[model samples]
Target: MINSVSIVPDFFQRVKTISFPEVIRVFYDEEPRRSKIHCPFHEEKTPSFHIYENGFFCFSCGEKGDSIDFIVKLYNLRPINAAKLIAERFGLPVSNGPLSRQDMLRLARAKAERLREKRLKEAFDNWARLAGQQVRILAEAIRLQLEEKGLDIEEDLLPLVHELPRLEWWANILAEGTGEEKLELFRNKDFRRWFTCKN
Candidate 1:
């Protein structure tokens, strides 16, 4: 059964970030700032679980979250889990959690997601600008290297030479191929040689 008032501090104060593994540790160990609890996600002893002031990582079963997310994941649960848990523990009738409280959480989550997406977009914008400059520099350097080596440069590769794909696309592409294929696509050996020789 969960406590009526959270023994941990307010969610905001408890952690700046949260992760599953750390929460698991808080559940297990008697950390000074965090509490020891049985990791609900897995079987264990001696409380290898932990939760940060902000509810970050867990050392066991890799269950983690912010206070809310922690609770959700802890139960192998969903957004509705808290409401249900509270209802069950307190012997109250379950009615879709509390409407007002759940709505507030939904709002907070929506706002947070928007902010995260905006921040990510901004970061990508910055990376795009930097990549533009980097691509130019790389292109120029590559051109010079090719020229010095008396190698023919492909005229069609200007775009590819100038900018890396966006991070999302890059991730997708990297994940799309097999290890050997990805290594080949990335020209990993060439990069390694370049880095080693440059140093």
Candidate 2:
């Protein structure tokens, strides 16, 4: 039998290091929050499988794991699969049991490069999400202001008016804003420029 006790430390350490989202894409659909996705290992219509970022636990079956446990459970794979899967997705190579010090350093460098790319992607997505939210709030505010001023437009006018400044009110607000005021300054370009310059 595999010595679970002896491997626990290594197992957990590897899991901690592996990128969770990349693993989900291998056996599960791209989107995990869909409440269901077609299980690759079986045929079903309702898609009872759900993959979380940290792990996957099928409601239909009790298969679950961090990335390593995931590969093993799904394909009857071993730690080798765990290493290979991570390396393949991350574009690193599996480690040979016997490596010279130079080879070991190369593996470490590859792993680090993979990790940095993952982090950059995550940060970009987060920035996009936040930026999108700010744009939405600004659009809503402009719509309300235009309506209040009796400046009505058809649906087609949305694109044209979105980029126009109704007034510099948001900028003025930001100029003397408290902490909350500064946080909401994304709606105003002048304020954004001012803040950027000031900083």
Candidate 3:
């Protein structure tokens, strides 16, 4: 019903003007880089999902839809309900009925999922920051081994250069991997060990 452009509500047209990135921010930690993020409808390593002025497309999953459709899939809501939720969140002029118990549960679950994802991303960010520092420390440790080592902690870092190739790969994950890939490294026990070593 709402899909028919000519017969759509005036508020629906306004919804088109709503920034998709802003819509994403309502339930996400930040706006996605380059207008893309991991697909909300499916698991993906790369950011194959992109948002545009009127809609979104996930290259990996072949999912495509407008702003309301994005919300429907992201939160697993009915199309009408998704539109109403968008209206309420963006302060658009659309009539939204009282929430059903099921609607409440769906919203609650969506919010909790968003929170869990946010915490995970925050943890990854902290770990990535540490990894970056380790990259610098690895360089310094290699330097100390090659040219300047009178320090007592030199014993722990003597092998830094030898492990350079492997650890550099981990550092590159922080530099270039997708959100999911970056988080994947954070969950790696060995990757955590390198950063925690005395530097």
> Which predicted model would earn the best lDDT?
3
| lDDT of candidate 2 over 3-85, digit per residue (tens) | 64565556446544755666665445434436445665567777777766676666776555667776776677776656566
| lDDT score of residue 171 within candidate 2 | 39
Question: Residues 4-116, candidate 1, lDDT per residue (tens digit)?
Answer: 45623332232323333343333433322335555556788656556456555548767665655655665566645543543333233343234476556665675576567
Question: Whose TM-score is higher: candidate 1's or candidate 3's?
Answer: 3
Q: Candidate 3 at 31: error in angstroms?
A: 11
Highest TM-score among the candidates is held by which one? Answer: 3
The order by descending TM-score is 3, 2, 1
What lDDT score belongs to each candidate, Candidate 1 first?
0.46, 0.56, 0.70
- lDDT for 99 in candidate 2 is 59
Give the per-residue lDDT digits (tens) of candidate 3, residues 27-122: 566448788878877888888888786778898889998888888887899877787788666545453344677657666676677678678768
Query: What TM-score should be assigned to candidate 3?
Result: 0.51
Task: Please report the TM-score between candidate 2 and the true structure.
Answer: 0.48
Per-candidate RMSD vs. true structure? 15.0, 10.4, 7.8
Between candidates 1 and 2, name the one with more favorable TM-score. Answer: 2
Query: Which pairs in model 2 have colliding backbones?
Result: none
